[model samples]
Target: MLDINNILIFFSIYMNKTCKKLISCYNIFFTEQGVRHEFR
Candidate 1:
């Protein structure tokens, strides 16, 4: 049904946004660790 398709599209878009956020956060975590090591 058209309604089901719409839901899938919305879900995919939200998931894409969330995925990007998670990846950016993960990178930041590693960067923070590297910076901490340098300071130590």
Candidate 2:
């Protein structure tokens, strides 16, 4: 059986990568225009 700790670690890593990708996307959007408030 899979270990619960390992599963949690994997999920956290995935979330971290997703967050980084989102930040990069936000930077790109910012350079295109400063109207990021619409995204919020």
Candidate maximizing lDDT: 1
Q: For model 2, what is the alpha-carbon lDDT of residue 25?
A: 99
lDDT of 2 by residue, 1-40 (tens): 4699899999999999999999999999887676666565
Question: Which residue pairs of candidate 2 clash?
Answer: none
Angstrom error of the Cα, residue 24, model 1: value is 0.6
lDDT of 1 at 15: 100
TM-score for each predicted model, relative to the true structure: 0.81, 0.72
* Candidate 1: tens digits of C-alpha lDDT, residues 1-40: 9999999999999999999999999999999999999999
Q: Runs in model 1 with CA error above 4 Å?
A: none
lDDT of each: 1.00, 0.88
Clashes of 2: 0
